[model samples]
Target: MKFVNSLLGLSLLLAASSQAHALSRNAGQTNQSAQQESPDSPRPILLNYTLLKTIDLATLSQNLASFGIKARNGVSIYKVSYATESLDDTSLNASGIIIIPDTKAAVFPWVSIQHGTIIAKAEAPSVAPFEGLAEASQGFVAVAADYIGYGDSAALPHPYIIAKGYQKPLVDLLRAARELANQKDFDLGPLFLKGYSEGGYATLALQKALETDYSTEFSIVASAPSAGPYNVELTGVLNVEKPVVNPVNLPFVVLAYNYWLADGQLALNDIFLPAVATVEDALSGAYNSDQVFAILPSTASGLFQSAFVADFTSDQPTLPTSRDLRALLRTQTLLDGWIPKAPTRFYHCIDDNEIPVAVTEQAVATFKAAGAPSISSVLIPSPTTGQPYLHGNCPAIFSPLQWFGEILSGKAAQ
Candidate 1:
């Protein structure tokens, strides 16, 4: 198979938006029927893998304290390109990063990582991977998808919260990464999943997609999705409209989603005010997530129309426009609790201001209600003050290492 030579775009390092301070970080479908893939769906095929960088053991150990990632020896990082169909079935190339521990182990335990929300194409795994890259140091083959709009496919519109956002590229990347690992003479063993924020939501989506649609093809030994807005309809869309949400998510989700899925079907005015509607196109990738906040109003009241904002604050959404948003939210919620074949744990910080911890709690409760005893949760307290950890700080705190290390350690032993 042919491949792109320069993997993970070395230039992506400078444009990596995930570096805007640590701490960070989708829902769609009925949680089951939504995963049924057409037998003729685009099968993921590995096109190529390009060597990016080598993380030596000493370098890994030196950075261990700052990032909490510990490495035994050196590791090889590769930029990968694979064939995947777009939302409408147009063939497209997706990019991701794959890291292999430079060890002599006969079999490699693998983990697939999903990145949190990023607006710039440079913010992807090949270029940025941000926290997802941390897992690479932990003596495993760590993989992450750039999704559709980043990396090689940067020109494409980022689908944001859509189901296929994670389902398609993530699975395809996992399969392609496995193929590359095999070709390179690495044995594959246990597979696990971990992600936070947008990555967290996508993590759940990927887990369910694999379990429900590709059960015969793959299995996750365990999964941990932290601080994702699982209840999208209520906690995300509905909650963000309350006028206090960080403000950027409203325009980011509302505009990008309609652009990718309902661009022609819904008018800009249908979703935002005339001011916002006129500039909705800018929300696409023309601006990075941070840029979106700068260009758009910083407060929900300033960003949305008065009527729509009023409706969101009311007892129940009554306006046709308000109802339309709710419908969209229902299409993406993850709180339905699809049972996982393996042990799954949800994580969140109680002090999180971005995504309420209640959403994770709700997901755990739903799983328990469905008799999924293997499903549980862990609340990571603010390590410093022992108080609540807000959004941005959590990513730095979680640091992508040891977050899953202890739990996965136990599972690996069993």
Candidate 2:
């Protein structure tokens, strides 16, 4: 925890001298690609930026040493506000952290990391530094989007598992990063996407949109979307049928859908029991996940109305409200529609309880059935427990950063 604090503390130092030295506009040589910007394709994505802090090589290496990672270069952390859109296509300002590696390499690859479930707005990447710092030190220009419900859009409710909701902000952020690179006179190399849990779902959403809608504008080198509930219709909603380890997840999703999908007209009384229907107050970006968890019930039946639970769990749900909820869940599915063109790897712990390993297996099987080329899955066991790697253990045990190292080193094919 001290190391994490050291990272946050280092990010708060706002020395102007270090800031100037870190991103000296005239320091590095410009790339030919930077000079050949398309005339009509202006850099209008970036709205504004702030130099949060710069981490020196020694300090960066010390901070990452505990994770068995050695820093190769220093990095400049910037909190960037960019032009993006909400789920309804309304133009808005979204924010994210861009960690630029302080290397003389003229060009750097873009690695966008979508973070896992963070209930509080303060935990957003621009607020608290995480993997982006380590990724920057490893020579990648890492980007972490704060997403809609956090950062600049903190006033809005987070659109939890909605695919299009995650897609828009991330795509715009990448475009904004490109604009930043062009302005900084540096060239961006291949784009790599990685994320875990909710971020994993967001990564897949971004990848699908890039491949399906924006292929001509952006090309992905590879993507690792690990431990996500890709088939949300089945894997996500079925949490009600099982004893949940994480209680806040279901309520959060319900409230998100009510606000985004049903336009907040689904009526809380129709979804949750009277005792838990006021859950929106706890999930309003005010409490952390643990605090929210303590306030909610451990089982879906305990939280949701018994009749609503029965309708949801039934094979042929009769109620119109139940059917409407099912339709919304179906729309959130990332599994069936299209096959991925990039080298995609699905990583998960074999013993994960929060999100079952079967989610990945189901997705892989569906993709294989659809003739998805260059798709694979890796299920790992816990080094410490040796069994039940669990959802929290998956990221540490089968890390995407280590996987990216292999892909970059050519040890793992991309």
Candidate 3:
């Protein structure tokens, strides 16, 4: 027993020493590169996964100062990556925040966060609105994926409707977290999934894919998805008259179809005017959400007059006949016959002006009808008196945390 114990200790010591050496080498190389660059045109400070873990709040604040990522009291950030197999072409590159407890024992449960639509690095923080739940209440590690076209890789187009494009990043990110946990110093127990709006849809689709595709590698403890368009076709139909949903989401959906369908059958000329032709180039290369939204109104107006509308409307007969056919073609859908294999807690506000709450209700009913295990949906009542929360706010989305806590504590309905 003593010999075996000594051997294990030696192995741990070797691992720790190797990790420290690698960190030192990387830091030295970075410093050397910085020195070679001109003082006026210095290279951006890049934080790696391992170096980020070694930093405390104070050190993190100092490091982020250079990058303009303000490190507030409760906001904790870290960098990470994962190898994924779900992408159609190139490997997915994912990077984002990680909030976990200071102590080892406290780190067990994990939550993977997905952000909303067209949001890029500038608005990336929005992806972690309820970060407190992961860092404080749940004692879990919360990881947010920046998706393929955001933050680190800003040149690629955001794949809005292409499920595989998003799925690769999500799956790879979760795998990265698990890989991090397996390290000698890291410890992550079970994991739960959560997201809002487009993120919500991502969470559900990821959960479904994990169960059916990557079940051997990942086990989801629970999931909470809010205001996601689980059924893409239905969402496009409902949003045409609403305008808020269709126009805002059209570019992303069209981009996804263009990338995923592989035929290059979808064209900007079909939907947008010559003036808006450059819009796709701008959007595809955007590094922030503000840029995406800035181009929406003009882009939408141009699409209204295109032949693409007629073809799209003709393709999706279920969409309201009165709505423009082009908008319907750009709508979201679930690619027939996809379902989740885990218990999921669905939440939505009854008065949500953005994505309709009815969409959430429909998803819940669909999951239940399909005999999903331990599925529950909660409709948060409109603000009563003192409290008022808008769409995608934290407090309004508390039920998901509660459900996740229940699952972590082994109390979730099976």
For all candidates in order, the CA lDDT equals 0.68, 0.78, 0.57
* lDDT of candidate 1 over 132-222, digit per residue (tens): 4456666668888888888889887777777777687788888887788777777778787888788888888988899889999997777
Candidate 1 all-Cα RMSD: 9.1
lDDT of 3 at 409: 68
User: Which is better, 1 or 3, measured by lDDT?
Assistant: 1
TM of each candidate vs. truth = 0.83, 0.87, 0.71
Error of 2 at 159 (Å): 1.0
lDDT of 2: 0.78
lDDT of 2 by residue, 1-414 (tens): 343345445544433443454356336631112233366975456777776667889988986776567999999877788878899999888898888999967899779898888887766777766647778888999999999989898988999988988898999999888888878889999789988889889999999999999999999988888888898878655676775536667678878998898877665677776454358777888877767777877776677777877888789878877778877888899986789989898888877777788888998898888988889888777666444456764544226677677777789753
RMSD of each: 9.1, 5.1, 12.2
Tens digit per residue, CA lDDT, model 3, 8-124: 343344335435655675766521111223579733222235323233455434533432334432323344543443356654445655555555563467788766675443434
* Stretches of candidate 1 exceeding 4 Å from the true structure: 1-44, 129-131, 270-274, 277-282, 313-315, 383-388, 395-404, 407-414
Residue-level lDDT for 342 in candidate 3: 70
Q: In lDDT terms, which candidate is top?
A: 2
Clashing pairs in 1: 8-126, 23-392, 23-395, 23-396, 27-332, 28-331, 28-332
Q: Arrange candidates, best TM-score first.
A: 2, 1, 3
